[model samples]
Target: MQLIIMRHGEAGRHSLDHERELTEVGRKQAANVAEKIAQSDSKPSVIWCSPYIRARQTAAIVGDILGVPVKEKSFITPDDDPGRCLDALLENKESPLMLVSHMPLVGSLTTLLSDGHRNGMPFMTAQAVVLDMPVVGPDCATLKTQFLP
Candidate 1:
């Protein structure tokens, strides 16, 4: 199984967190990243995203290219622990899964798998981290590819 964790693109300043949509540059970034994601030949079986508009919008971009449905996974939010997030992914029998979420959570979760340190947390807007592993625990999803948008 493969897990593709992507952070939402840049949003407007002072906008409502749930209502924030992607900016013009963010849209382009998502498109570029989507292009790269499509090259995988193995698209996500489901595009899981935060209910937040920014994340949903980001997922929609790649979903357009991958032809995957965008389902809001509330556990991808900032305060949500990655355990629930990983559980949701594990429950899916799909080959590749795309998760669109926030910054610290994405970075922290990645660290929980790749390394023990969170000092190098860096998930840029529209950037994605692709992991290859068994459909098991969070530790199983080792970092495979990091895509910058």
Candidate 2:
């Protein structure tokens, strides 16, 4: 299976963390990444996104460009456990899955899957890392490439 782990675009600060919205620059960043993905062979069958506004917005852009369905996964939230998120992803049968989420979770998930360790990667806003995995487990995936916008 191929997994694309993406961090949400830059967001404006809000009193409610979940309510923070993407900035104009963030939208442009998402658009740039979406265009890049659309030109690639790695189209996602399904997209999973955090419920947070910024992540959802980013996922929407990708899903629209890729013509894939997007679903909100609570486990992909910023502070959620990477192990649990991995387990949830493993439950899906879809290949070429995409996940739009926040930092720490995005970076940690990539590290947990690629290097068998958490916090091994630090992702910038609007960055994505692709992983090819035969099965879901620690260190089971190889990094294909990273896309940054």
Number of the top candidate by lDDT? 2
Candidate 2 lDDT trough over 10 residues, lowest sum: 119-128
- Runs in model 2 deviating more than 4 A are none
**Candidate No. with top TM-score:** 2
Could you estimate the TM-score for every candidate?
0.90, 0.97
Model 1 lowest lDDT segment of ten: 112-121
Scored by lDDT, model 2 comes in at 0.90
Local error of candidate 1 at residue 73 (angstroms): 1.3
Clashes of each: 0, 0
Q: Kindly provide the TM-score of model 1 when superposed on the true structure, using C-alpha atoms.
A: 0.90
Pairs in clash, predicted candidate 1: none
Error of 1 at 4 (Å): 0.4
